[model samples]
Target: MTCLICGTPYQSTPTWSKLFLNQLDSSTCTRCFEKFEVSESTIDFTDFLGTPYEGAVDSVFCLYTYNEPMKEFLHQYKFLQDVALAKVFAGNLQQAFQTREGIIVPIPMHPEKLELRTFAQVDELLNAAQVSYQQLLVKTKSETQGKKTKMERLETSNLFEAMSNIEATNYILFDDIYTTGATIHHAAKILKDAGAKRVDAITLIKG
Candidate 1:
């Protein structure tokens, strides 16, 4: 098979360990991937209600707009048990951040959610990207952001806390999806309050 991103034919051997197999065939050619670059698109950060705010995340960098194979990949990564897809998704993010040097932080999941899912997809992606990451933000309590409207989500956005021993540094917040900026905004706010010089966000898909 050929890699859509890199056009490389699949190697006979797999890159992942024996127990960690990929659902999608791995055939990305070296050349196709080499041409890809990570970049930040110009996006305005606003609360769910379209209320713009300063000091919300400075920028949001997405690898792809929510579409096609990427969308299916995300669906599998988030809902189904297709954890391997997280690695491919993270590869795009890694390419986007090739020139960046900072602590990569995942947006984080509540303990209950983490316990239910057994993993944070963003965390898995960061690990797959081979990037140095710190779990800087912690969700103190369970608040269902999925059910709320944009403004409602923004209004009750005091959900995260900066973990202890997280040194202030240039950091990027990572997540799987970007719908309204509410979650990223709150996560960035905590990092900024904790003294991160600049807080930028990177997501696999933008909605």
Candidate 2:
């Protein structure tokens, strides 16, 4: 009935699944949504080959690229604290995780940052997708990764600690973005060290 991004009312043609499954509807308008680009497969992690982070993550699946549209979207969703934007990708995200066979675990925000951001963006994405996930790890450090160089990020001390007992099963690490691979690697390494059988990752974007 209405596009979430542009605010101009638009008609969403009915589909079979929309009629039967009570699924989430498109929150983004065709014009705005088309501006966003879906990326290809996993990002380049060849730099980690000989590093301690090698094999820390089995694979990474990214849904979108950090294109201009995505850049704008993230600004509104995270920095501007528009929680509703999380629903824009709900249906797509649900479909992505439908075939994965691991326990979903979203990367957590630090307490202070969570207070500032008002909501956990990563968790909100999963919730908007109606995907169940466990909060197994807690962020112990709050250093901003945006300013750090690739090597600086890789060499930084671990930022997470397990908040609960991690079962020795495969776990899917979910995050909002994959930048230098530091956050995912640190989180995955923590899970691996805590005895998770396998750790793979999925992100909303590949930066």
- Give the top-scoring candidate (TM-score): 2
Give the range where candidate 2 is weakest over 10 consecutive residues by summed lDDT. Answer: 17-26
**Which residue pairs in candidate 2 collide?**
none
How large is the C-alpha RMSD of every model relative to the true structure?
6.5, 1.4
Model 2 stretches with alpha carbons more than 4 Å out:
17-23
lDDT of 2: 0.89
Which candidate leads in lDDT? 2
Q: What lDDT is reached at residue 38 by model 1?
A: 39
In lDDT terms, how accurate is model 1? 0.68
Global fold similarity of model 2 (TM-score): 0.95
Please give, for residues 11-31, the per-residue lDDT of candidate 2 as tens digits: 786778767765677687789
Candidate 1: clashing pairs of residues: 3-28, 6-32, 6-33, 7-29, 8-28, 8-29, 38-96, 48-150
